[model samples]
Target: MFHQPNSEFAVVCRFQGLFPDDIGGYEKHRTRNGGDLGHVDASRSHLNRRVIGNADWAARTIAMIEDMKAENFADEIETLTRRRRKKQLKHRMVEGPRDPWRATRHGPMREVILTANRNWFDAPATSAARAARAQAFEDAARDWLLANFGEDVVHARADLDEQAFHIHAVIVPKVQVELNGTTRWMLQPSKHDLIKNYEAAQDSVGQHFAPLGLARGERRAAAVRKARQTGDEPPAYRQHVRTADWRKAEDTKIVETRAELEQRAEAMIVDEIVLAQREAGMIARENAIEVREQAAAGRERAAETKEQEADAMLAVGQGLAAGAFDIEDRDGTPALVETPEAKPGLLSKLRARMALSSSGRARALHVFSKALARLRKQSRDEAKTAVARDTAEIEAADEKIVEIASRLPDAERRSIGKIRLSLSARIMALTGRNMARETPERGGNDGRP
Candidate 1:
């Protein structure tokens, strides 16, 4: 009923202890809590299908080993004890009751792990195809066990619940012994020595599966011979690493690596934000410096203009002091002359002095008015600049708040949004106050000149 296995596939046959004392925990794990193991996916446990064998490993062991022992060996043991008593009475010899099938040295059961190459079954993914492959393997393995070990194979189970489909066959090692006028089967693991003849067992199983293209693994003897030829020691047999432990370690590494990556990413983000803030601060400082330079240049220009006006007023006063009028003959008529060197008459001097005083007062008054206007304009410009800078900073803060709020939970985001709105309102009020204060109507500066 089994399909031909791919030639590339190989079979695995491992023998290990499955003692009577270990059966309770083993049965619970295999039957009930298999999903709790690392290799098993609890969510896909529904896909796990049992091929054969009952859940009561303990009962099965008792029935096959202890019960059989009591049934067949009880009378023989009693008779042997009676004989031993008579022998002890006749001779000075140490005699004890015969317990031939005692299980003191070795347990009654040993487990065999049987499976084809894992890839053969796992390659096919579709439900029907995968099921067929699993069924074929199970059937072949079951038949092989029955043919090779007979009734000694007390329990056979195929587990499709782990990483791969495999079969566990429980075998009781026993042999027929002829002694003390009776023939009986007795527990004798040392005589059978299945674990000692592991290579032979693998070879036998491999031969059975040869028609299906399954091949045996390399022999230890062959490996030893090869090692001798190469002038090296024979390789030591290594124990199988548990799939659960391997997977757990790998998962832990993956989690740790992922967490490290996340932390690095967060750190990078924070660094970029800090850099951007620093750049913004630099830009603001540069802008303020430019504004101050511009205001200073304006003040310098105003000072130069005032100096020139003062010089012009002084020149007028000097001309008025020199003379008010100059007399010169032109076409035989008398003409008044105004010059720096011309001497003034008493009446002319009086007129010039009165005129100079009146002009001086007006010029001084005009200069004072112009200076006041310039000062007022400078103050207004400074106030406007301050208001603009504050407004820009407030807007920037609002934008930052919005960006941060976007990452928060809905409730927290809503609360932050309310705060942002209040901040915006306050900013608006501040802007209004700045604007009102800067206005001429607020009496900050009136352009009287």
Candidate 2:
């Protein structure tokens, strides 16, 4: 059901093309990975690798090595990957020592990293069990990297401590001729390209277990959705960056906009005043007649009612009345206060507020119970949301990885690469012909897709 794994782990891989001795090249490339995050190599392999059984030993070895050397892979790989859709921009994260410090660099070193990870993980039952699981993942990762990139990977090993598990690979680009005497350009795959290959490898791994009734695809999908909603996320700047200044700027813009609006309102008011001026005389004459008629109607009502409630009079023609009536009197009561009584503190003359009346106290407990129930419900909702987020992220990562991998060049799919090239050439040739046939007055556009 799946073409690749939606793994809840991050992996890194680096590759360097071999240099011939005749080219005045040295062993610098072999030692490059060792210098990367040195702590990874400092661990005693005998003890760590022994933690896992033979069945998972290879998996554990690779995971540990990858974790150690990940730093050398590249910085801000996830950021770069996310920005890929922008098309026009290459996400280059500028880092290093601040103004005063800088690290030494040998040769013109450049690298692109491809990282794969899900946001959630399976919990361990015991320390030994956790160690065994870790060992298995690392071991498998080691073999995976060598098998995909080549056996020459033994020359590189990075030490990232235990911060994360990722592979580091290095390859210096140079031209070389194959046995067929065809000279080819040496190059490191782009980040997008490398991830494609990695995902393809994972697809192969998943299929091998299919006959054993192990279905990886479905499990990965469910786990990914669960991880996404649980907030088991990779580090993202949205969580860390503050937008207060942006909001403040937006408020200022609104204030300025309101000032302009006020000017517009003043103009509108003036126009309204002018319009009223044009209609004022006719409007006043009509209103006067209305008032006179209303007055006559009110007098008729007053004469009819007599003295039952002397101060009351019937409403006249919807507030067009000219006749006045007496106001009611409630002269003895104290005037009502508009302000609330303030609570006193310290040595103020006002008496203290009682902690609570018996009924008030009982009501307070009822309110507390309601609040507690609400809080519990809120907590459950939050937990559910977090789990869903984690799950989504994992699913997205898996699908993207698989799609890229399916397009990569693998052992059985090497011929697929030729197919891609042939198709691309045919497409380009047809496109050129179409463009040539089109009128110059018309232009190409994005609606094509």
lDDT of 1 by residue, 1-449 (tens): 34465568888887766566567666666666533476765676575555445656558765455434433433453344446654432221111112246555446457878887677777776878878877777778888877777777767777776778888877777777776676666766556544558777878888877765678766777788899999999989766665667787898899677656655677778577668768987997999999899989988996766555444444333332344322233454322335444445644544444354453334533322232334356667778888888889988988999999999999999999998898799878979887776755312122111
Tens digit of per-residue lDDT, candidate 2, span 192-300: 2333363454464444433322233323444556678886853332322212455556778996776566556777785775577559857978998998999899878
Per-model CA lDDT versus the true structure: 0.62, 0.35
Query: Pick by TM-score: which candidate is best?
Result: 1
Candidate 2 lDDT trough over 10 residues, lowest sum: 316-325
Candidate 1 — what's its lDDT? 0.62
For candidate 2, the TM-score is 0.23
What does candidate 1 score on TM? Answer: 0.48
Q: Which numbered prediction scores highest in lDDT against the true structure?
A: 1
